[model samples]
Target: MATPYPTPISLSKTCIGWTDIGLMGSPMASHLLSVGHSFSIYARDPSKALQLQSKGVCLINSQQDLAKISDIFFTIISGPPDVCSIILGPQGVLSSLNPGGVIVDMTRNHPALAREIFKPARKKDSWSIDAPVSSIDVGAREGRLAILAGGDIIQWLSPLFRIMGKHMYVGEAGCGQSCKIGNQIVGSANPLGLSEALTFAERAGLDLKKVLEGIRRGSAGNMIMELFGPGGFAESLVKDLGMGLDLLESEEERAVALPGASLCKQLLCGMIANGDEKLGLQGLVTVIERINDIQK
Candidate 1:
């Protein structure tokens, strides 16, 4: 056999890409590479490019270069500012595109801005699609990503997207963003509850293991406990069973995790506020420590 990877498929793809590759994007790109999509990357930090380099991935010098070469450009950046600059700024991809090129912004951006990206791209015979994606590192590498797409271009890219995510078509322009934000609210449920549930145990002087057992293997059991739990819950658990991060990772949809989801934030805030702010965000343990100190 010649090779299973980089096989010449019926589709020809060239992508100018930017990704916040700390976790999800790594596996996503690996899958893209396996399918033989030529890519060019332009991240704010060049050091982030090394991992892709190790995988024999091609590096594109700038967003402009990306626009000049690729017919379909994609981005998975962290925030809106990053999204805007890559597509709209002077050094951005928009300034240097050939007619008929399209931008597939996988990052969930503000619905309003998503519309804005479409306006200019279309004027030049190009297009932009707000197809926000949701999946963790494991799913991306496995080509089992779940995407919430907005706009007609989805039909055009559906075949390519199948290589990245499971289909979750919501609707056009900003509807996918709406769904992605909603998904994050659901994703936050477990972590927020864990903070409160764990704090209560430590304050009561209950054995953490026993407390975990009491709640788990029962109705109180949740996805977070199942994955992050101590008894045989090692790194492989996350590796084996994938986590759905929601489209909340991208800029447009990041606040989607925020809007209309006050319960999780409120609970976490209460847990954190009962303790000193001096300890900072990951210091939920301080709340229990302080309450116990007072009781003693």
Candidate 2:
């Protein structure tokens, strides 16, 4: 059966509040403010938001203060714990969110936590939607992210969603996080496979550029190869994969099998051990090289 989506309402007059003005969130909030959303921000590290403030975005001192002024709150913090702290904490957004207000959490969090947030929002006559985005720094800056929304209120938030990225209404609360976990699982596999292949070709003394060209034109061609060709940070990937594996372990009934993701996690961990956690996904090739004793 199809789930019903609320009709999108005009948000022309809605006041928006955003938090966590980091690499991804900064640009996302900028896009909103650029489009004239009457935007405000609550930044823990105020320095990160100085430019936004200079551009006329109201920088509130606390989430409580933000809640009083914002009709719609958007957060894209680091993990589940921070999500809880910002939304459910003593001075969190929900502590004083106006009735009929909405909270859109764009963090890639545990699915269960997303659902946990939904209940209180309902009790207060507000709404919580989990809408994790899939994109890197450039994509976020360019507003080209792929957003996965898990809630019925998505339609009502369509105007805002359109500015951030292309969004898919997945299901009830928490489903967006679940889908993002699956996305990380699937996304991790491609880059790992590409890195392995590249490492092999390099070890065989093949011309890497020629080999990459052939791969790009061949059956193994994929978006990961195109976007990263051979580079991306392993730290974020490690966190995402760890969360994915934990989710699988917790859901015993599902019995899903994804050995590639596990192996990818291991290789990424190897990258971290080698002190290359700050390096890109192509750095995984170094791990493979290390395994074969091929010095860079």
Against the true structure, whose TM-score is highest?
2
lDDT of 2 by residue, 247-276 (tens): 667753265677888899999899999898
lDDT of 2: 0.84
RMSD of each candidate? 8.0, 3.7
- List the lowest-lDDT window of 10 residues for candidate 1: 232-241
- Cα deviation of 44, candidate 1, in Å: 2.7
TM-scores, in order shown?
0.70, 0.93
| Model 1 CA lDDT for position 225 | 62
The RMSD (Cα, Å) of candidate 2 is: 3.7
Model 2 spans > 4 angstroms off: 1-12, 229-232, 251-253
Model 1, range 1-296, lDDT digits (tens) per residue?
A: 11111222234434535455656666776677777766666656778878888777667677787667776677777656778988899888889877767777887466667777888887887777887776555667678778888765677667678888777667876676666655655555555466567777876888988888988878978665654422111121121111123334545444333442454444335454564323322343444445456342
Model 1 residue runs over 4 Å out of place are 1-22, 202-207, 210-214, 227-260, 266-296
Model 1 pairs whose backbones collide: 108-252, 108-253, 109-252, 110-252, 145-165, 145-166, 151-172
lDDT of each: 0.62, 0.84
